[model samples]
Target: MAATLDQVRVPRARAGRPRTRPDRVLADKGYPSKANRAWLRTRGIAATIPERDDQIAHRVRRRRRT
Candidate 1:
């Protein structure tokens, strides 16, 4: 996916290199793993995805115990 993003080209009016990286990435809960989120963060891209139900439940359970 990173490679694909790098290959993207957007024409500009002034004349310069095309846009390589996107400003943000929107994905579903299935794509919001720790590694995936870390990867997107490292690339300076914002990710807008909700946590999975299981993850949310686990967090809530843990919080209650503390």
Candidate 2:
């Protein structure tokens, strides 16, 4: 099976053309991960993914000062 989209725009094809990238991407619960955030930062893409419950608990346990 394959997904035949109406149009596809990739960042790789346009080194010469101006890159008008999106400001941010919003992913739901299934995509809340540290690596995902880091990757988005590398590309200057803001993410709107909420932290998972386990991640929130760990952060709260270790980062009490904040």
Candidate 3:
């Protein structure tokens, strides 16, 4: 995933350097890992990755307790 993301090159309209960081990433649940999400967050990239089933269940349980 890191290798794939590093290869991204979005050209500028006027003229300049290509964008290394994309505006957003739409990935599957399988791609939503703590490391992956943190990487995108630090780069200020928006991600549309769904939480895994276990993660969702854990979140729900935690919420109910509070």
On a 0 to 1 TM-score scale, where does candidate 2 land against the true structure? Answer: 0.59
Lowest summed lDDT across 10 adjacent residues in model 3 is found at: 57-66
Tens digits of lDDT, candidate 2, 1-66: 002111323365546753444467777787787777787777687889887898889888999876
Residue 38 error, candidate 1, Å:
0.6
lDDT of 2 at 14: 42
For candidate 3, write residues 1-66 as lDDT tens digits: 788999999788888999998999999999989999999999899999998999999889999984
Q: Write down the RMSD of candidate 2 (Cα, Å).
A: 7.1
Every model: Cα RMSD to truth: 2.4, 7.1, 1.9
Give the TM-score of each candidate.
0.74, 0.59, 0.77
Residue pairs with clashing backbones, model 1: none
What is the lDDT of every predicted structure here?
A: 0.80, 0.65, 0.91
Q: Which is the better candidate, 2 or 3, if ranked by TM-score?
A: 3
Error of 2 at 46 (Å): 0.7
Query: Which residue pairs of candidate 2 clash?
Result: none
Candidate 3 runs further than 4 Å off: 64-66
